[model samples]
Target: MPLAEIPLCVWRKRGQDFVFQGQAIRYWVAGQGEPLLLIHGFPTASWDWHYLWQPLAQRYRVIACDMLGFGDSAKPLNHAYSLLEQADLQQALLAHLGVDQPLHLLAHDYGDSVAQELLARHYEAGVEIASCVFLNGGLFPETHRPVLTQKLLLSPLGWMIGRAFSREGLVKSFRQIFGPHTRPSESELDDFWSLIDSHHGPRIMHKLIGYIPERRVQRERWVSAMQRGDIALRVIDGEVDPISGGHMVERYRQLIPSPDTVLLPGIGHYPQIEAPMQVLTHYLTFRDDLVSPPRKAACS
Candidate 1:
């Protein structure tokens, strides 16, 4: 599939861009009400949220961006990608959108870590995150199971391995993560492969995988943000996911105070795509709970 002809590109019409530090950053916005920022995972761009964008947009002003190095955003070769850098880019995006009011957040995979960094800024820099919900992601490196290709791409010879990365590997790795019942179609795979290979992105895959180590090194800072109570937070997980699904949820329950988790059995890593309606239901339920009044104490 040609990048421009992908489903997300064709369906989406409100796309826009802004230059940040001399690089063009692409973002999409639609709908109205309180702004809801959606951050996509690693190896993909804002298009990952395509399934949830319209529905959620009907209820909230939806905003999503192709974080630098992915999708329509500028991919600068030899540039280092980090959670903090992405978070900063997010900040810039919000600023460009003129979103000064408090906003809700929904993130998945690499995007979850980016959300954590933004949450931390909520404390350190007073960036108001009204609420947050995390989908399958490696919040705790210990629970993360990176595929063999991921390990190789992050290895010492990663530079060479990244150059040699193929569409076959992309299909195999992506397919293996989804549940047998909810695997993405060939069209979806083609779009994904096209996005990754766009603008010579595959050549820099190794550099993008750098987040695997950055996660461990910055664990204290990010995990602390997840554990804090200043902001309401919830986690929706795909139980069958081998990467950051069941195991990551287990760690979340163990560490987060008053943790809220939704388990989707038989589902895999990308619940937002594989089980979007279910994910949307859980998301709205979480948001409603955050705003709903607590029940009055029973008369004694």
Candidate 2:
């Protein structure tokens, strides 16, 4: 008997090519109900949500798109990529998709920062975000431990590093963030490498990583939105992730008011890939709790 192909291949086939800012943005929309937008992290694309797409789509309209410089999207040279620009791309894409109502947000990695920006917009009544669930990500830069490659990417030598970076180096760095038990399989890693290598994606590493410092500069604004907003918010973390694991969760609890957190031991940065069901459970619980009417007090 022959082995079956990876599940993400199905998504690749289902994805539609959409236009955003004259760039061909790769996107997938499935299921039907309240919109649940899945925002992916840095260096990876919407495929990060492949594991949970079908299951989550069962109950809600699930939408995901590759940010301008990622996945099957256009990767332009010498272009500046900022979190604000990423956020703008998100808004445009949603409007194009006819998402007029507020959206439920599930974000990971760099996408978490983008979500924070959207949260701020909601705070000002510029946009509406129904709720948000943050996965393993650098919500707090102080708590974030950027790998050496990330540091290099943010430095003046970043361009040279991006140009010289090899697939093996990327794989090694990627594996370093996963827990020992949940490292991605070889085929999965190959898929990631292929996405990054597409349209010379690696060359834009420095630009995309500019979000790190932007997080620090905009901390007060983004954090304030999460703390003061009416939306129900949750943070689910992979405890063993070296990047933003337990330590980030600690900061989140200390800083965010009435913090709701789920800690998964032995998992890593990519919880969706490592522990898909657990992530889905937490997500659905949060979504359901928000939708369910408040419990009425029993008669005294």
RMSD of each: 4.6, 4.2
Model 2 accuracy (lDDT, Cα): 0.86
Q: What are the lDDT scores of the predictions, listed in order?
A: 0.84, 0.86
Clashes of each: 0, 0
TM-score of each predicted structure versus truth: 0.94, 0.94
Q: Against the true structure, candidate 1 has what lDDT? A: 0.84
Q: Taking the tens digit of each residue's C-alpha lDDT, what string does model 1 give over 86-115?
A: 999999888988999997999999999888
For candidate 1, list the clashing residue pairs, or say none.
none
lDDT of 2 by residue, 201-233 (tens): 888888888999999999989888988947888
Q: What clash count does candidate 2 reach? A: 0
